[model samples]
Target: MKALSHLNKYLLKYKWYLIWGTTFTVISNLFGIIPAQLVRYSLDLVKETLDIYFLYNGSRLQSNLYDVFAFSILFYGLLILAMALLKGFFLFLVRQTLIVMSRHIEYDLKNEIYLHYQTLPLSFFRQHNTGDLMARISEDVSKVRMYVGPSIMYGLNLITLFVLVISYMVSINARLSLYVLLPLPVLSVAIYVVNTIIIKRSEEIQRSLSRLSTFVQEAFSGIRVLKAFVREENSATNFTVESDVYKQKSLQLTRVDSLFFPLIMLLVGFSNVLVVYVGGQEILTGRLTPGNIMEFILYVNMLTWPVMALGWTTSQTQRAAASQQRINEFLAVKTDLVSEKSLEREIAGEVEFRNVRFVYPDSGIVALKNFNLNVKAGETVAILGTTGSGKSSLANLLTRMYDPTDGVILIDGIPLKEYSLTSIRRQMGYVPQEVFLFSETISNNVKFGMPEMPQEKVEQAVKDADLYQNIIEFPEKFDTRIGERGVTLSGGQKQRLSIARAIARDPKILILDDCLSAVDTNTENIILNNLHRIMENRTSVVISHRVSSAKLADKILVLDEGEVVEHGTHEELLAANGVYRELYEKQLQAEEV
Candidate 1:
């Protein structure tokens, strides 16, 4: 119940819908109960007229009274039909207002969750799986909608009908009404007990559902791997286990849910029996008539559906509460990447790391320690390092994907945090070790960073990356659609496409993080020759292990175990006979062989 309180704002937002729906519900119930009274009047009129007919049997007056009696019964029947039609119309209005409001709220809620997801840090994503996140937005939201829409509408209907029907019953015969309602207290106790059990079971069922969704999502996403490894049977067995767990949990809930209507009907049945037995005693004492008994029966029948609906409404509300609790947990998480300043400024690409140290939050691995570097604007610096030497960490910090734990990073003499994230990212083009491209046309992927880029610039970027020939060979050229994550392209082609995307942005600062590892030496040389011209005025940081890639840089750095072991120009580093020289000599021998 407390978790459901989060929706109070949405309720207030659509208060007019709720107000009108409530009005309609009340009117519908009012019209509904009137038919029972009409039944009572028709029954009493028939009883009285029959008695009069008996008294005037075979007399001249009997025939005249017969027509009047027929007309009276026909009039009451018409009134009952009108009441039913009016009740139905109001019910339609109730669904239009309330149900439509729920849909509007659902739209707003999903958008809010998705927008919040975009703001969360990468570490948050690392901690959660894709399937669970998707379940929260899709499945959990649907359950909450049930609470806001059908559960609320039916719950209100139940209360309204009960009030009208019970009040009328008491007014006619208090003693008989008391006996008929005696079983209701027992029904109340049953509802309370069942509601408690349902909430617990509902939570279990939701958790099982999430696990099942995750299993199916992972299985499909890795189907290629599974087939390559010949693990189809094993995967199917695992799926069966997850499915069985979900099935058992659902059945448990259904078993409990199945008790609801029967218990309600049983209590209702007792109420009906009490109405008949007690009403008969009242008639024997001349305090009640046959019309009263018949009307009481009609009223009890009128209350039956609402009472039966109570179980369903309660179950849905409990499920909704469980789902809302899950949603609230994520909504309450605060991202640590808040910007202290949001001013947009032009980045001159003079990047500096002053005593920077960082540790990966999830793995607790120290990726950088006392790392310091300064690159002047319009300079090219190549960082050479072996695996696990913290080469990629610099790129992550420069992009502000993760902040350093210890020191400050500055761009153009301004602290990195001083500029807005959007401004900083917009001016910098980064090609990471792991390249990702959308399942879109070649031109669209190239122009992703700048959607409005011209076709000439797109061609130039493709040429600069040395991928122009391959793209032109395709039937659609730049318009060719690459499959998911560029799966249709070869590894080198994918890496080159990523480079073309970065180049298309025309960024002031360009960082290529080992993007040429897959291309042949000839292709790499061509790209480097083109980059020599592109890097003339722009700040560029080329991170790689190959000595050939660093030969053109103004300065070269050799990193060992998260620390800089050597730094100098290529000629100076070769003359120094240190780690950089050793790496160069080894790579040169391998190329010669």
Candidate 2:
């Protein structure tokens, strides 16, 4: 009952639909039951007129038995035709309403879930794979719809059938009706046991299925990499392993599923047998009429559905409960990054980091420590470091992707937390070391696939990135579609396009994390020179591996092992005999060799 009570909450929005649907079902079934009753009643009326034929000592029929039989046949045919028409109309009506309700509920819930994902921190995505989350939105949500719309309608029909059958049975013989209901308790117990197993197994099956899908997606996306590495056998083996787990789990679920209805039928079979046997004896003893016995059998036949439906509903109820619990668990994890609770406002380009220390949510130690820096309203600061020295992590802090564990970041001398995330984010443009591009047209990629953007603005951004000339050489130019992750583009092209997309917004503070790494030094110089022209009077952070790249910056900071070891002008840092001097001298020596 509590499970049903929980399910009703989702159904509350569709109360009017259920009310009209159930009413139609009841009316249709009333006409349906009439024909069965006519057969028994017509036979009883014939007993009044037939010849002496009771070898078992039954009463003879009265006069005009053939006319009575003919009238009953006509009424039965008319009742069936009327029932068919009513049932068909009800089918059309309920289907239309349920389809609308299902679509509305699906859309509303999907939007809410998507918005929830937006509010969660980046750590959430790191902990869960992209494919599994996609499956939940697509496949799992569809299952929820199944539970909501049609499941409810069929459930109502089953209940209506049960109620009508019981009322008619009471009219036949009260004591015998009680006897026919004897196995109902057993039916309940069986359903409870089977439902528990199905629920537990279904959850396992769903988890395994998600994992299998994730593995396939990962493999497909990295197929070129796997082929280049000659890891096809390994990839296939890994997929096979995942697929096997899903297969076994699904079979275990099916094993449980196949037993649900038949086993319930087996338990309820005795009642069906007992009704005919006991009701027939009552008739022979002159305690019940033939029509009464026939009516009782119809009622017995009707109990089968609710019993079977109870079993199926039991499984569906548990699935919905499990799904809700999983969704609740996801929503319960508090986000580490918190935005401003107040109004959003514009931000000035000035940024300051005071003794900032950052620790990744997954790591035990700080990735950036004791960092102190300031960028004026319009300045270019370049960061120099070896791999794993927290270059990209520094840029991430500016956007508040992860807040510092110990220190404060300020915008226009106000604590960054004071400004809403949208306001703060709108002022900064970032191009990561690992460039990510969507599958879309070249123009859409430049626009980051924004549904609406000025065409001239996109063209300007592409020109600024120095990719406009190359794009025009492609077969379709601006209309040329990019593949997933920009697979169709070269590494340098991808990085340039990502840079173009970020720059398209005309941001106040721009950060490039070795985004020019893929291009040749000559090409890199051209793009950087172009960026300088466009980013005039704008605050910028640039990270580059080549020592020559730092020469264009107003100031340079050298980092090693997450600590800022040296900071000053490019000339001053080389004279300081610190991390910057060492890195510069090493690159110089490599070029000489």
Candidate 3:
């Protein structure tokens, strides 16, 4: 119930819808009550006319009275029909206003969750799975919609009908009305017990569903790997286990949920029996007429549906509360990375790391320690390092994907935090070691960083990355749809496509993090040769394991165990005969073999 309080703002936002829907509900119930009264009046009128006809048997006046009674009964039937039609029309209005409001709220809520997801840090994503995140936005939101729309609408209908129908029953005869309502207290107790059980079971069911969704999502995403490992049988068995858990949880909930209607009907049946038995006693005592008994019966039947719907409304509300609690959990998370200032001027691409130190928050592993470097605007610097030598960590810090645990990073003499995150990222192009591309056209993937890039620039970017020939050979050229994660392209082509995407952005600072690892030596040389021209006036950082990639840089760095072991120009480093020289000689031997 407390979790559901979060929806109050949405309720207030669409207050007019609620107001109109309530008005319609009241009018519909009013119209519905009129038909029962008409039935009672028609019954009593028929009885009185029959008595008069018996008194004037065989008289011409009796025939005149018969025609009058026939006309009156027809008029009553027409009036009842009109009331029912009006009731139905207003009920339609109730759905239009209330249900439509719920849909609008659903749209707003999903957008709000998605927008919040975009602001969350990469670490947050690491802590959660894709399927759980998707479930919250889709499945959880749908359950909430049930509470706001159908449950609320039916609950209102229940209240309105009960008030009108019960009031009329009591006014006609209080004692009989009391007996008719005797079973309602028992119904109330049953609902309370069932509602408590429903809340617990509903939460369990939702969790099971989330686990099932995650299993299916992972299985499909990693299907290629599963096939490669020949683990199809094991995967299917795991899927069956997850499915069985979900099935059991659902059945448990359904078993409890199944009790709702039967209990409601049983209590209602008791109320009907009481009405007939008690109303007969009243009639025998001459305190009630046959018309009165008939009208009471009509009123009881009127209350039946609403009373039955009460249990369903309660169950829906409980499920909604459970789902809202999950949604609120994510909504309450505050992102750790906060932007301090907005950049008003274009970046000059002079990057500096002043005694920077960093540790991965998730694993508590130190990736960098006392690292210091300064690159002037438009300079090319190549960082050479083995695996786990903090080479990628440097790239991560430059992109502001993670802040250093200690020390400061500056761009153009301004602290990195001083600039707006969006402004800094917009001016920087990064090609990561692990590349990811959308399942879109080749041209769209190339223009991913800048969607409005011109065709001429797109061609130039592909040419600069030395991927123009392969793309032109494709059937659709730039328009070819690369499958999921660029599966349709070869590894080298995918890497080159990533480079083309970065180049198309025309960024002031470009960082290529071992992006050419997959290309053959000849292709790597060709791409490097083109990059020498492309990187002329832009600040670039080349992170790689190859010495050939560093030969053209103005400066080179060799890193070992998160610390710089050697730094100098290529000729100077070769003359020094240190770690860089050793790596260069080893790579030269491998190429020769």
Candidate 4:
């Protein structure tokens, strides 16, 4: 019912179309009743053994004598043709208008869902499958569109059939018509009971279908990894299981669907047999006439659709319910942190951490505790740490990806929470440990941060990142498509592309999270030298395990076991003969050996 209600809101917007649609439905029924009445009158005329006086539709045309058989055939034929013309004319317009409205609903819903997904915080994506999210936006929204179109049309058609049939039945012989409708309650109950099962099964089928779609999407996206690992058989087997599950669920639901038509036929068939047996005796005993029997039979035909539509409407209702549930689930999700706070002034890059403590949700392991640091604007800082040393978490706090649990991270002496998320991130040009480029042209990827960039700006940024020469070397130059995740490009080139993309924005502060590890030492040095020129009077934070990169910064912080164990200039850290010295000596020894 909830699914039906949501669909109704949109359908009601075009009420006049449905109004005319239902009115035309009744018009079809009116024409449909004419053939049975004509047959009975023609039979009565023949039985009386009198010359059949035909008005020829009141035109007084001679259609009589030896041509009576031909006249009867032509009369019914032309009536059927006229009925068909009326039915098709109205049904066509109704179908066209409904489809247009359904398309509008589909377009609006798909765009809105996609936009909502974009605005949702990062954690929402982290806990959900990418393919599942896609299914909710694509497949489920389409289900709603299908429901909105045909289900409403059919459901209303059923009501019109009921009203038209009952009116005709009561007008002919109220007492006899009442007896014919005796089987209706039984038929209704049967439809109701069977429809419940159909609805339940339909939901199961839809869910299994989404799971299969997700599996296929994931398989395609990660095909390269599977092939590289020689896991083709494993992937195929997994996909087959998902597909088979989908098939079984669809078959099960359709099995229920198959039962519906047969049940309606049986019940309606039983009613027909009863009406004919009883109505025949009534006519023979002078209690009724052949005309009444013929009319009842026509009414029975009218009843067929309502029974058939019960099955279709049941299926559509169930799909809509499932789609609504999925959409509701997405709308309910809320992110733990991040906001858009408006401030009167712009933020300078000076960053401070005061008594910062952090822990991940599932893994309650403390990644940082009582972390404190203060760096002034225009000063370059480097962080050296082993794996899982909370260096990345610290950077995440500065970018406001995750907030500290027990303390404050500040920018320019203002709490991070006080600054708008956009304002905070706009100041920092961050390059993650793993570089990713879109499956788009190199120029488009480089200019991604500032898409409306001038050609000169894009070219200059590429040059500053030391990637312009490499891009021009390609046959298609910067317009060449980078394969998925920049797979077609070398690791060094990918990192430089990431650098170019980040540099294109011309941010006030830049954070490089060991993002240039793939480049040679000489190349890394040159990139760093260029970065220094760009970062002049601008803050920059370098994070790397490589000592060569650390030497470029004016100050360094060495972290161990979620704690900052050392902080100083390169010479000061070497003089302390602690963690930084040990790390420096290890690199030197590795080169010498």
lDDT of each: 0.91, 0.77, 0.92, 0.78
TM-score between candidate 1 and the true structure: 0.95
As for model 1, its CA RMSD to the true structure in angstroms is 1.9
What number of backbone clashes does candidate 2 have, counting pairs of residues 3 or more apart or in separate chains? 5
Name the candidate, 2 or 3, with the larger lDDT value.
3
Q: TM-scores for all candidates? A: 0.95, 0.92, 0.96, 0.89
Q: Could you give candidate 4's per-residue lDDT for residues 1-593 as a string of tens digits?
A: 76446556556776676677667666766666666666666555555433444434344444344366667657766876787677678667667665666787778778877887877765567667777788888888887877766776777678777887788778877767777788778767876787688767767776787787778888788788888999999989998888888888888877777877787788778768867987898888887677678768867876887767877776777777778777767866766665546553565678888999988654577889788888889888998899889888777777777778889887888888877776667667888887888999988997786779888888887887788888888999878999998989998999988988887788777888888789987788788889888877778888888888887788899988788899999999999999899999998898677
lDDT of 3: 0.92
Give the candidate order by descending lDDT: 3, 1, 4, 2
Q: Is candidate 1 or candidate 2 better by lDDT?
A: 1
- What's the CA RMSD for each of the models? 1.9, 3.4, 1.7, 3.8
Model 3 bad stretches (over 4 Å): none
Model 4 pairs in collision = none
lDDT comparison, 2 vs 4, better candidate: 4
189: Cα error in model 3, Å: 2.2
Q: Across residues 378-448, which tens digit of lDDT does each residue of candidate 3 receive?
A: 99999999999999999989988888899999999999988888889999999999999999999999888
lDDT of 1 by residue, 1-593 (tens): 89999999999999999999999999999999898888888888988899999999999899999999999999999999999999999999999999999999899889989999988877888888888899999999999999999998999999988898889999999999999889888888888898899999888888888888888888887777999999999999998999998899889889989998999888888888998999999999999998899999988888888888888998899999999999999999878776788869887789899999999898899988899999999999999999999999999899988889999999999989888998889999999898899989999999996889999999999999999999999999999999887888999999999999997898999999999999988899999999999998899999998989996799988998899999999999999999999999999999888
In model 4, the runs with Cα more than 4 Å from the true position are 3-80, 285-292, 336-340, 591-593
Candidate 2 lDDT tens digits, 90-199 = 76776766656767777766776688888887768877987777767766667666667666666776777778777777776787888898888877787778788887
